[model samples]
Target chain A: MRDKFNEQLEQLNVELIKMGALCEEAISAAAKALLEGDAALRETAAAAEREIDQKERDIESLCMKLLLQQQPVARDLRTISAALKMISDMERIGDQASDIAEITRDIEDSPVVSHVPIAEMARSTIGMVTDSIDSFVRKNLGLAQEVIRKDDEIDRMFLDVKDELIRRIGQGDSGETCMDLLMIAKYFERIGDHACNIAEWVEYSLTGQHGDM
Target chain B: MRDKFNEQLEQLNVELIKMGALCEEAISAAAKALLEGDAALRETAAAAEREIDQKERDIESLCMKLLLQQQPVARDLRTISAALKMISDMERIGDQASDIAEITRDIEDSPVVSHVPIAEMARSTIGMVTDSIDSFVRKNLGLAQEVIRKDDEIDRMFLDVKDELIRRIGQGDSGETCMDLLMIAKYFERIGDHACNIAEWVEYSLTGQHGDM
Candidate 1:
């Protein structure tokens, strides 16, 4: 019975890693859609969002089964509970990515996009999302802490995006377009936040310390 | 043993209702601060947010204790798991309210505030938050469904806010100030989304159905 429980726990880790990869794909496709101004990638992001949602349901059912069948305690209980919480954050990341794609699909050629370092922000958030999951899979507290720390960099980048958009508007750029860019930048900032949340849950699972930012 | 478990579950419900009330206080205070241009109310909202956070921690610990001590099955287990998930959305509602207040405290005499129906939007979101919690307490699936439907109203209000901001920008309003107002409206919109999430969790707790929106 103990061996069977361990096997199920291993399966949980594999499912979480797969869900994290889907989030990365969704966000990356959304970012590329914005940077390249390709409406096609929006569909890619949307498809990934659907897949992520399905994965959330599947994993949630699995977690419920584990808890019911094993009645896990201590460390095992914490791990499963943390997984339940972490999936919500992962699902939100997918939604934010889809939202970014929605905005990108409607936007035309806007010069505001070039002035902001949105691509760099996207890359950093993607790294944070990936590393947060890796920390969970490997049970590495230090990597989870690093993921939490990296949120500051994303916040700083959001401020930069805001400042540049303000400058462009002051220079008589289209306010409508700048607002669209602002919304996109805001979505990316939110994705970073959700990634930070996932890392916090990872910390909670490993250390039983619920760290709030 | 079962009697003690039921008592603890009752306590969990009490704590959840208290946390929900704090979220309501935070959002209401934030809306009043924005409408009245009262920086003092920002501190009020911040205080409520702090209380909400503390309540989350306390309730979370209670939940862990219940799970470990009773090893609840079936409906009892679903109730505890749902409580675990609902708190996160409630906590986010508190954070978004504080965020709105933060933006409101910074702005000085903006004409866009009059143009947008922000006050009405605030009232609607406040209603949704209240109803969502009431549904959870009553386990009324219909009330929870109503809360989810109300999110559409909030979304419509957000578009109105966006359009008004765009019109003001065309008339040469300060782009920076309009951006600030937009962020505040977005925060309200996000609060509505979180309320919808809470209602969904309430439905799940009662019916064992995870309805994604």
Candidate 2:
């Protein structure tokens, strides 16, 4: 029975990691689609979203089964809870990718004012997300907390993107153009926030406190 | 041990319901402050928020203790997991309320925009959230699903609110004033969506499905 539980946990862990890998790819594809004006990559990011949704369903079922079969306790309980929470953040990260893709689709051929610091922020957030869940699967609290510490820097980068976006809008960009830029900025910031949320959950699983200890 | 477990479960139930009740009140106070033009009520809502945060901390610690002592399984696991998820949603709901309060604080003295459908939407969301948690405490799946169905109404109301706000802004309202309205509308939409999330969890506990099972 114990061995079965371990195997199930292993399956859940592997699936989540795969989902995270897809999310990382989506982030790259979406950002490149926006920055490089590569329309085909936008479709690639959008196509990737359906796979993330499938992965989410697969992992959610695995989690429910783990709860039913494993009957985890204490630290085990924390692991399952953290994994469930991590998936929600992961799914939202996928969502931010989709958001970026949708914006690229809508803004096709429109002249972008500038795409500064957003790709950099996306790179940073993707790294944090990958590392946070890696920390969770590896039971590395130090790495999880390290991801949390980088959250402020992501926020700062988001602000820089926001400042540039706002500067354009204030200079009398049309409502449609300004709205598209604002939405893109919103997606980038949201991706960072979700990574921070995942990192916080990992920390909680390790320390048995939400943002505590 | 069973009796002890039941006692802890009941205590957790009580605390969660209390927090749910507090969340309902905060949303009401936030909407009331906006509708009645009572700037002071925004302060009252802000003060209430601190208590909500404190209550959240207390409940989380209590949940950890229950997990440690009861070491619950099956229905017990479902109950505890449901409580944990519900509390997280309630905290987010409280954050949404605080956002509403902050918007109120910004535009307390600004000219009103025809009352709109905001109060109605806020009331609907608050009631849905209150009842969703109530459904959990009572373990009433039917009631929980009822809350799930109304999520569409909440979304529709949100669209109406957004349309009205944008129309008002387009009519040459101060950009600052319109932004405050936009923020308030967005907060109402989030509170409703969170209520739906709580309802989804309640359904999960009942039928082992994510929502409306």
Second chain TM-score for model 2: 0.93
lDDT per residue as tens, model 2, B94-213? 877876887776676566445468878888998898889889989998888888889889878866765665565456544455545655776787788788888888888777777422
lDDT of each: 0.89, 0.76
TM-score of chain B of each: 0.97, 0.93
After superposition, candidate 2 runs with Cα above 4 Å error: A1-12, A26-77, A99-106, A112-121, A138-142, A157-170, A207-213, B1-6, B32-77, B103-108, B112-116, B211-213
Q: Give lDDT for model 1.
A: 0.89
**Cα deviation in Å at residue B178, candidate 1?**
0.7
> Ten consecutive residues with minimal summed lDDT in candidate 2 chain A?
A169-178
- Give the per-residue lDDT digits (tens) of candidate 1, residues B44-79: 999999999899888877987887678787778888
DockQ (CA atoms), all models: 0.57, 0.20
Q: Give DockQ: model 2.
A: 0.20
Identify the CAPRI category of the predicted complex in candidate 1.
Answer: medium
| TM-scores of the candidates in the order shown | 0.95, 0.79
